[model samples]
Target: MRATIALALAAALAAATSASGQDLLLRGGPIHTGEAQVEALAVKDGKVAFAGRLDAARRAAPGAREIDLKGAAAYPGFVDAHAHLSGIGFREMTLNLEGATSIEDLVARLKAWDEAHPGREALSGRGWIETHWPERRFPTRADLDRAVANRPVVLTRADGHALVANSAMLALAGVTAATAAPEGGQILKDAAGQPTGMLIDNAMALVRAKVPPPDGAARAEAVRRGAGVYAARGWTGLHNMAASREEVATEEALARQGLLPVRVENYMSLAEGGEVLASGPSRDGAGMVGVRGVKLFMDGALGSRGAALLAPYADAEGTGLIVTPPQVIAQALARARTSGAQVAIHAIGDRGNRLVLDAYQQAFAGDPAALKAARWRVEHAQILSPEDLPRFAELGVIASMQPSHAIGDLYFAPARLGPERLKGAYAWESLLHTGAALAGGSDAPVEKGDPLVEFYAAAYRHDLAGRSGPDWRPQEAVSRAQALAMLTSGPAFAAGREAELGALTVGRTADISVFSVDLLSAPFDQIAKAHAVMTIVGGKVVYEAAR
Candidate 1:
């Protein structure tokens, strides 16, 4: 049967190659059209031209470059609904301590980096989490002081919601035990009333502002490098959360120069997006770059105990901090309604989610028409009150989530929220059942930013090693089909490009991701092992794995 199908596909491609005008043709393996499976697909002028039987596609587009799948499967291109592109690039260029096993290991890595770059005045890095550390606690200033006491050293937690600074950095920032933390932030102190050199949420600005900003050239390079990395990893596009005005300008410049490898939908940070919000959303002519909305934070991340919770943390003292006030969220939503721009707010805890939901409801109530037009998103939506789950659908809010977060956070989430709150933690399927839209993402630099890993995390609901604790709530795992949509159509809908992107239909853009394994039929374990064979964006092949 396989041989027979191959012969037929070859004949169809031969017929297709005879005519002119079509851009490309793909055949030999399954092609998921979002509606049904097809044998072949053809592209023309960057849009899908035909999707059906190989012979039919060939007749429809008789002169296109043929790409044989070679047993691989093709689906609508995957889009990371939430990510930080520049951070991904910076991660590549800077010191990364993502897998440090202990505080000593992290300190040693920092020491090595400091010695290697002795010419630099200050040191900065990110991607360190202490959840699995043997010490079972957050790193302190004394730990980093051992590495580089002379220069300022600031290392951010993996969640980006907090940072631990060396004594030098704390001194440079003028942060001391008497220094009051800004609203919606925390300056962790020792029992003796001394600064611990840990700053959470808004408090991080003190040290961060002291670090010199990167030049325009470096900023542009970061955008270019990040886009290339994502394309090679099978992501056709990304919704860049917390994008700065400078980064948006950098992306546009790269797109204009034809240097960008993948599509980028930018949601600028509230602090830097005043102009974009005033001007409203804008897209490039080629559909490769877009300034879509504003990204706001409702609270910090759960890992750092900064996420605003309704109740005190199970193992800690107080409820997480509210990073943004309800009045501020409401004001942003109102502005977004008038500007015709989407709003994507980061909310990780039950209280944070509730605040955002309430603001969205009030904003919608005032402008029913705007509400219908606005496909506003709640990024992370990691932990939600059971009652607030249904409100997402009621308000037509998009739950922009990262699956890898669930898998990684599960290791420590049980302790952070205890068993009862775990019920609402990472409740993906439950949200889906409530008719809420869930757009999947990787949140790279924080996570690995690999589409395959995200898919595996969502479908299996297990750690990389396939472990799942009893309280991990394996029942929330989504079906493979649902997972696929989350990365494709779901993101497209979230970005308001459902009519143009996402599906492998005749009218949609020719963005397709061909993978080594058939995701729909492969064993759950094999999904993560699968690699991208070919990535097609806007009818152009961006990345192809070496044969």
Candidate 2:
């Protein structure tokens, strides 16, 4: 029965491709429609006009400009299911310390930035991780003081859940040993009971509150720059996580001006999204930007040892912190249900995942229909209790995961959780086997935010260096087809736009991404090295690589 339906759809598509009047014709490569490979595709207005034979597409769109793929691969547009768009732009603008090999290197970069911009009042930078540092410890205030003794220096960790503030900055924030860490936060201290300048999770807000906020102009530019970067990297759209209402407005303004190169679906932060939740979802006139839901954090990231865990960490002492209380999550769920808004909560540890699941189950008490209809998601569903694996599918919750995290975090995760808990860490294939849909993303700024890298990571389950340890669980890696769907249809399904945005079918929006290599057939190692040849959104060419 399904075979007959598929054949009829194919025949209808063939007939449509034989008709006339399209705006663009794409040929000369394998065009994958998530169902079959086609010789050509035609775009009319902003939707797919046809997908079939190359000769028929040429006849159907005689007046259309043709795009020769030159052996590149084309597929339904890739949408990052999770990311921080503005942060990606800010990383470009700020004192980026993304690859500092050691604490001294990080300090040297800070010194260089400080010397280059001597007039600035304070120093702020991000993207430093101590995981691979030779010293094997987080940076300290004393370390940064060597770079800028007089000025306040605050540098955030790569995970965005922790920061190291120099003594000057700590004094400016009035944080001392006597100052108590807020709930769900930690202020690390030395044995002498002095503040060590490392703040985890909620505690980072203390120093951040002291930093000057970016003005409206700066904020707008970040959005613009971030969108351009994503488009250039071949991303057709992104699910912007932790977006502010102001950021949403900025995106809408950009879309109105036709300055936005890629589609944006925002999940505003819970603190700033009350109005949006009450008003329901909204989209720009051109359908380029939309506010789809609200984002909340259940726990901090695993790298910082702040992820709420069921058991104590193998290396650390505690069970980790809970950033948001269970009651708050329950209230948010209830509100989302009433307002018809989706809820995406960040859950990274076993305890965190279980708490979120518990809240969801409680909210879904007697309404099985609403449970599936809500399409609620757990962002970064990274660590989980083996027992709770089936709960995601049973509750109809989406697991919006970033493949790069598995490859990156595995470097230190085994030591943190021990081998006993390794079974449920980044278990992508396990979740899928249990009937849960997994949406893929890069978590940009946090990771490199490159689609090709993300695809490679998902399929290979190894670090960029092509290395993996025994406890890394390489078996959790997905197939090429599954990875492709995660980047396309899975995200569409998660966002409740599957009918209109996921595939290259007639009447669906014409969004396509062309890459240098055939992602499905390329050698695993070569996938990450491939670049984006072109990016198209709504039939408009947003980015094209030069020959």
Q: Top TM-score: which candidate number?
A: 2
Mark the regions of model 1 whose C-alpha exceeds 4 Å error after superposition: 1-22, 366-369
22-89: candidate 2 lDDT, tens digit per residue: 38999998999988899999898878888999888877767788989999999999999999999987
Taking the candidates one at a time, how many backbone clashes does each contain?
1, 0
The global C-alpha lDDT for each of the candidates, from Candidate 1 onward, is 0.87, 0.88
Q: Please provide TM-scores, in order, for all candidate models, with all chains considered together.
A: 0.94, 0.95
TM-score of 1: 0.94
Flag clash pairs in model 2: none
Best prediction by lDDT: 2
List, residue by residue over 10-101, the lDDT tens digit for candidate 1: 33223222323349989989899888899999998888999998998888777788889988999999999999999988877677888889
Supply the global lDDT for candidate 2. 0.88
